[model samples]
Target: MHELTNETQGARYSPTSIRATWDGTGSVKDASRALGFSRAKGYDLVRRGEFPCRVLRIGRSTRVVTASLLRVLESGEPEYSGGHTGHCTS
Candidate 1:
């Protein structure tokens, strides 16, 4: 595992660390951690089709595309902006 740093304060993942740690695809949990969010929140994002990167649903398994993750991290922007329009219950 590689250590991800938020040196830039707003940076979600360390591009270098991600590049060194993942090649093809990574778990939503791991991607969420890299994005500074909880695992449950990650699943929620996926469930609502609001994940920042490309997500693949294979059978009952969900995978986050490593390249898309890297691209988002490197570019400092989300590929998808499916923001919630519903009221926040939290």
Candidate 2:
């Protein structure tokens, strides 16, 4: 999933609204913006392979899996386990 940040060079968006929105795929910048991280940091995470989700590369474009991100945020755990392990009150 993609994390959104303030530095993304695109339309303005609120964090909560973006988090609640899902489209299955997003660019690197879009993910960074959603996660509130700098574009530079987002790329850095990609380079270090520390990002919690997988990134899909098609040609020169990179996209984050929105479902995985939403799952992690909603459950506070990775998405590979088939079910969320964390509890959400809301």
Candidate 3:
């Protein structure tokens, strides 16, 4: 499992790890975990259209795009930055 860095309070998911672990898409919960957030929060973000990555709605299930997630992880910026600088302040 990946751990959150104390300095950023964010979990870092390498492209290799993501590619190896997921196929084309993954659950919002998993994406949230990779982004260092809770499952509930992930759902909330999806509902609010503010998740860091592209989301696909298939019937009643929601899937986060693996490639989008990887891009966000690599860029360290959510789809909605909301003035956030992708840094944690002490």
Worst 10 residues of 2 by lDDT: 80-89
Local distance difference test values of all predictions, in order = 0.77, 0.59, 0.76
Q: Which candidate ranks first by lDDT, i.e. highest?
A: 1
Model 3 / residue 39 / CA error / Å: 0.3
Checking candidate 1 for backbone clashes, the offending pairs are: none
- lDDT tens readout by residue for model 3, 1-90: 234355333323456777887999999988898888899999998887688888778778989889888888889977642234652323
lDDT of 2 by residue, 1-90 (tens): 134443343334343545566567767676676565778887887676555555666677867777656655556564432133452313
How many clashes would you count in candidate 3?
0
Which stretches of candidate 1 lie above 4 Å from their native place? 1-13, 81-90
lDDT of 1 at 81: 30
Candidate ordering by TM-score (highest first): 3, 1, 2
| Global fold similarity of model 1 (TM-score) | 0.71
RMSD of each: 7.7, 9.6, 9.4
Question: Model 3's lDDT to the true fold?
Answer: 0.76
lDDT of 1 at 89: 28
